[model samples]
Every structure is written in structure tokens, then in C-alpha cells.
Target: METETRDITITDIRKLLDEVTDPEIPVISIHDLGVLRDVRKEGDTFVITITPTYSGCPAMDMITLNIHGKLRAHHIPHFKVETQLAPAWTTDWMTDEGKRKLKEFGITPPMGSKGSEDLINRHPPCPFCNSENTELVSAFGSTACKALFRCRDCSEPFDYFKCH
Candidate 1:
């Protein structure tokens, strides 16, 4: 029988990744938003795969740094951050816990696509009032990934997770 030693470990690094948060929206972890794809050991280094919420969303730089910082603290010295664009990051990939956290953070969760059309046709519920009487204030919110919404019942403005 022969003994083998693995120089790199991934499970621990992946666990520490939860500490990294979106710089713009601290309440959401990059992982929770479905941005983080995978972390694997590649020889003496690490391969981190991430998908951006949108093609040109500006939060990517900070997201990368946050992940790296967390990884480095966990002793993952050599790592590569790779961007994976397809099958692309979709609102559908958002987890139940992620949705609940978003609502608790005052952002509504996105519903599934209503049709074959590429546009986001489903109206998101208001996080504050949970009212369906919500209207789109604008398709673009403070961030390109989110839509601006107003709750008719509560007369409060909120960000809708509905996005293409």
C-alpha cells in the first residue's frame, strides 16, 4: 500500500467564502447572489469560478477582491479568479435562503420567467408590504441588475430582483 498527500484542500476555503460579501450590498454574499460558481484545487493553486449578475455590472472587481481576501486569510495563497458567462447567471439560480435573506434585507426576490420572451415579465412582490400591487418605477435601478419598484399599497419604493 502507498500513502498519498494532497497539497491543497478546497472544503475549508469554500467554507470561509461565506464571509465575503458584496461590497455595494453588504447584506448579500457573492455566493448567495449566485455569483460564486465553484472553487477547486489546481495543483498548488486554486481555481475560483464566478458568474457576474450582468455582463457589465461594476461590482465584479470588489467581489473578486473580497473572495481573494477571504481565501488568503484562509491560507489559499495562489488562486485564479475566472469569469464564467454561460449558461449565464440567472435569477432562477438564487437559492431559498438567498431569497429569504434578500427580503429580510429589504429587497424582493425575483420570480421565474413568465414566458419565452427574454424580458423579465414577472412582477416581484414588495419586500416591505408583500403586496402584488407593485409597479415598475424603472427597469433599471440604482444598479443595472435590479429594477426600481414602488408599492402602491405602501407607497414605498424598493428594488425588485426581477432582471433579465
Candidate 2:
């Protein structure tokens, strides 16, 4: 008897997912956000794990569709994407690399320790100038995903991912 092998690998999934940029920030990928939890082969298909940036984030739909669409285009047959919120995704989960990409894309990423209590703290330095002279303009930004803020030193408005 002969056994069948699969070409669907995590690398393939990651590569395909690399094509999935955050809808809000096209330069940064969802994987960069620490969103792509796990990609592994399971039987004849693949299994992907993801965590939502927030509980009510509407982008979840787009994310799922993106995974399916891209993988399907690559001729990937069957797969399952499991969403886990146990360690609910937070801005703090955003990696250093992700931050750099955000800055390069003209969007200021969130500052230190993303926690509910921490969001109200006024001491986070401006990601643009590394200055402590920044103020929160509003509690919301482009989407429920972010907040509006202005840097006192740079005098520029920026978005801060709501650390939910």
C-alpha cells in the first residue's frame, strides 16, 4: 500500500497569509500583528489558528475570507481556522517589527502595556518623536479598532490601536 503526502505546509500558509495585510494598515500583515497563531498540516488539509485583535472587531469576517480566498487561489483544498481568545489579542501583543512597519506606513502604533487600565494613562510617549507631550484626541479612530491622538511635539494626529 502507498500513502499520500501533502504539500500544504505552515510556510505555505504563512506565505499566503503574508498577502493578508491588515485592512487598516496595508503595509503591515495580519501575521505581523501576532494574529497568525498556528499553521499546521492536519490530515489531508491544513489547520490555522488566529486570535481577533478585539472581541467585537468586525475585521474578523474579512480575515477569514482572505485566508480562504488566498489559499484557494494557491490550490489549497481543505483547512480550518480556529479563533482563540483565551489570551485575547491586545495591542501589547503587537510585535516590535509590527510597530516598525506601522511607523513606516505612516500610522503610529500603540504605546506600552496595552491594558484597559493602561489606556487611560497619559504617559505614553509619541511613537513619532519619542516625546511625552502627547494627548488623546478621542477614544476612537478610523474604526472601533483604534483611537485618535495628537502629538504635542510633532503636532500631528495619529491612530492608537485600542488595547482591547
Candidate 3:
């Protein structure tokens, strides 16, 4: 018996990649994170482009490995995962569904663009209680990309998915 290969379309590739999740945040897929920049075929080889949430993010290596593993699982033989850093990632790239998932997982998604004076005075509503009474405990949380915050109304400590 011999195995047959079929031409992979962008949708097919995306469907495969959709199963790849961010190691840190299991609730959201990498595709929802907006890290997956592009996927295309180049001379029978699949090319996957990704951007890290931030420079030196430890999760990138694992993400790349997972991409390779996923492609292999789909029986894809030749593929390349490339990292692009020119256009920095922003919280704006995150999908609304992703944000909802984050909130449901107890991580408050970015409220808006970072460093805005308006955003400075505002604290993200608590994911647990939806209270506006939240305080920034620390600028950095379990990960550099997140911040530590505590809700005054609910008395719950949570991580805020900081905007980039």
C-alpha cells in the first residue's frame, strides 16, 4: 500500500494550525492570539509565519515546535516556521472570541491600547466579579506579558493580559 498526498489549501493549513494552542494559556489557540501571521505554500513546501507576543518570549520556541508537530500529525512532510518581528504584535490583534476566553479563564484581556492616559487611570474590570474596582498590584504577573491586579469588590487577585 502507498500513501497519497493532497494539495493543502490555506484553509486546510489554518484548520490544522487552529489546533495549536499557546502553552501558557491553554484556553486560547495560537491563531486567536494573532501570532500566526501567514501560511502559504511555496513549491510544495508549507511556510508558516508567526510573531511573538513580545521579544524574548519563552513561549515562541514551544509554539514553533507545536506547529511542527501539528503539521507532522497532519502528514505534512515539508514545512518551515518563520518568525517575523517587523510589525510588532498588539493586543488589538487578539480576536473578540479570544478575549472572551481569556476573561472566562480569569485573565482580563487588554482593555485597550497601552500607554494611553485614559487607560492609565482605568483598571480592567475583574474577570471574576466584573467590578470596576481593581488595583494594579504589580506591573508584571506570572508572565511579562501580563500584570497582577486585585479586585477590591470581589477580593480576588487576577492577572491582566496587558496590552502591547
- Structural similarity to truth (TM-score) of each candidate: 0.86, 0.84, 0.93
lDDT (0 to 1) per candidate: 0.76, 0.75, 0.86
Off by over 4 Å in 2: 1-5, 118-120, 127-130
- The deviation in Å at residue 27 for candidate 3 is 0.8
**Model 3 worst lDDT run, 10 consecutive residues:** 1-10
TM-score of 2: 0.84
Cα RMSD for candidates in order = 4.3, 3.4, 1.9
TM-score of 1: 0.86
- Candidate 2 vs candidate 3: the lDDT winner is 3
Q: What value does the lDDT take at residue 129 in candidate 2?
A: 80
Predicted candidate 3 versus true structure: per-residue lDDT over 85-142, tens digit per residue: 9788888889999999999999999986645233446689999989999988888799
Q: Stretches of candidate 1 above 4 Å error?
A: 1-8, 114-122
| Pick by lDDT: 1 or 3, better one | 3
- lDDT, candidate 3, residue 45? 77
